[model samples]
Target: MPHFAATLRTGLCATVLATALLGLAGCVVISPFGGHDDQLRETTVQGDGDSKILWLPISGFISDAPSRQAFGLVQQQSTLATVTRALDKAEKDDDIGAVVLRINSPGGTVSAADEIHARIQRYHETTGVPVIASFGGVAASGGYYVAMAADTVIAQPTSITGSIGVIIPSVNAKGLLDKLGVEDASYVSAEHKDIMSPLREASPQERRIVQDVIDSLFARFVSVVKAGRPNLDSNHLAEITDGRIFAADDAKRLGLIDRIGHIDDVLALARDKAGVDEARVIRYYRGRSAPRSILAEAATGSGMNFSAAGVPIDLSVDSNAGASQPLYLWQPPGAP
Candidate 1:
C-alpha cells in the first residue's frame, strides 16, 4: 500500500509539473521536458503600427546543423535554420518594411556563414526590403561575413568587428605519441587522403595543399566584403583582411561599417530606409511570450538552453562544438 501510494504521489507531482508548464503563457520557456512548437510567435517589442521591422539575430557559433544541447535531450534550430525560418516568414508578410540583423558572434564554420549570407542576399533581392546589420558584442569573421548581406552595417560603439580570413585548425601529435609510445596505425587509401592528419607532421606538399584551400576561401571572403562595402579603400584592404579584430571606431574608419551607434540608431536608419515612420519593431520567439527587452533573450545561435521552469539546462555546447573543419572564426589567445 505504501509503495502504491508513493507511486501515486510521483505520478501526481509529474502531472502537476506538466500542467504548470503548460499554463505558463507570459514567460519565455525553452525546456527539455517539453516538445518544441515549430511555429514561431511574433511579438511587438517596440512602437506601434501596421508595418513591422523584423529583428533577426545572428548570434553565437554559426552552424547549419541543428544545435545539440549538452544534455542531448532536445535539438534546437540551427543558426541557418533560424535565419531561413525568419526569412520565410518575412517573405510571406507584406507589411514587413525592413529587416534588422542583430549579430553577436565570434564566427563559425565556413559553409554556415556562406549559406546564411546567400539566404539573406536572396531574401533582400526578392523582397526589395532594406536589410540592415546591427553589430553587437563581438561580430567578427563569419559573423561579419553574414552581415555582408546587409545593405548597411552599423556597429555599436563598444562592439568588436572584423577578423576577416579562414582558419582550419590542426595539431601535430607525433611528438606526444612518440613520448607516450603510441603509434598511429590508421592507413589511408591515397597519399593525400590524410593531408592534414594530426597523427603526423604535415609534409611540404600537404601544407601547400592546405594553404591553397585557405587562400581560395580568403579570396572569396574578400570578394564578399568588397561587394558589401564598395567604399572600402583598396589600400586598407590588405591590412583589414589580415585576420585581426577591430573596435567599432576603426571598423567605420576603414569602411567596414557605415556608422557607430546604438540599437535605436540602427532601427531609425532601417525605418528611414524602409520609409516607415512608426512601424512596430518586432522579433520572433519560440516561447509563449516575447522577452521584455531586445537583449533580454540569451545568445540566439550558440545553442544555449533553459527550461520552462526557469532553470538553465544547457549554457554551452553546440552541434559543431569540436570538429576539424575550415572555419571563419575568431578565437582569441585563450578563447574556447
Candidate 2:
C-alpha cells in the first residue's frame, strides 16, 4: 500500500509540475501579443510635438553584417545594416530635426566604416539635417573615420580619440608546426600566391609588395583626413598620421575634433545648428515582431547567466581565420 501511495504521489507531482510549466508558457506566449490596439494607442510622441533630435548609437566593432543576433538574442554589435536603417528612419521622420551620432568604438573594417560615412553624408545631404558626433570612451581609427561625416565632432575630456592608421596583422605558425613535426604539403600556383600564408615566412619581395599596398591605403586615408579637417595644419599631418593615439584635448588642438564635451553638450549643439528652441530627444530601437519568451531564452541559452559585478561576460571569441586583410582599427594595449 505504501509503495502504491508513493507511485500515486509521484504521478501527482509530475502532473502539477507540468501544469505549472504550461501556465508559464502560456503567459510568455500571450504577453507579447495581448492588447495590440492598446499598445498602438499608447505610442505617443516623446516631449514636445515634433522637432526632435534623434540619438543614434554607434557602438562596438563596425561591420557590414546584416544583423548581430546571436543565440537568438540581440548582441550589441554595430553593423552597417543597423546604422543604415536608423539613418533611413531618422530621414523619413518629419519630427526629427537633427541627429547626434553617439560613438564608442575602437574602430573596425575600412570598407564598413567608409560605407557608414557615405550613408551618413547622404542622409544629411538629402534631409538637410544637422548631424553631430559625440564620442564616448574610445573612438579611434575607423571610428574617427565615420565621425568625419558629421558637421561637428565632440569628445569627452578623458576619451581616447585617435589611432589614425592602417594595420594588417598576420600570424605565422611555421615555428610551432616545426616544433610539432608538422609540415605544410599544400601546393599553390605561384610562389607569391600564398602571400600571407601562416605556414611559412614572408619573403622580402612579398614584404615589399605588402608594404606597397599599405602605403597606397595610407595615402588614401591621409587624403580623407585632409578633406574632412581642412583647417588641419599641413606641417603636422605626417606627425598625427603615424599610428599614435591621443587624448580628447590633444585631438581638439590637432584639429581632429571640434569640442570637448558630453552628450548633453552635443544635443545642445545639434539644437542650435537646427535652429530649434526646444526639441525632444528620441532614440531609435530595432522593432521586434514578437517578444522573446522564457522558453525561447532557455532553448537558445540567451539572457545573462553569469556576470562579473553587474556586467555580463562576453564569451565570443574573434577568430580571424582565413586570409588577412588590411584594417583601419585600433588595437588596445595587450589585446591579442
Across residues 61-122, which tens digit of lDDT does each residue of candidate 1 receive? 99998865434434578999999989998999999999999999999999999999999999
lDDT of 2 by residue, 101-145 (tens): 888888877788889989999999999888898999988998888
**Candidate 1 lDDT trough over 10 residues, lowest sum:** 298-307
**What would the TM-scores of all predictions be?**
0.87, 0.77
Q: How close is candidate 1 to the true structure, as a TM-score?
A: 0.87
CA deviation > 4 Å runs, candidate 2? 1-49, 66-78, 287-311, 317-323
lDDT of model number 1: 0.85
Q: Rate the local accuracy (lDDT) of all candidates.
A: 0.85, 0.72
What are the clash counts of all predictions, listed in order? 0, 0
Candidate 1 residues lying further than 4 Å off, grouped into runs, are: 1-32, 298-315
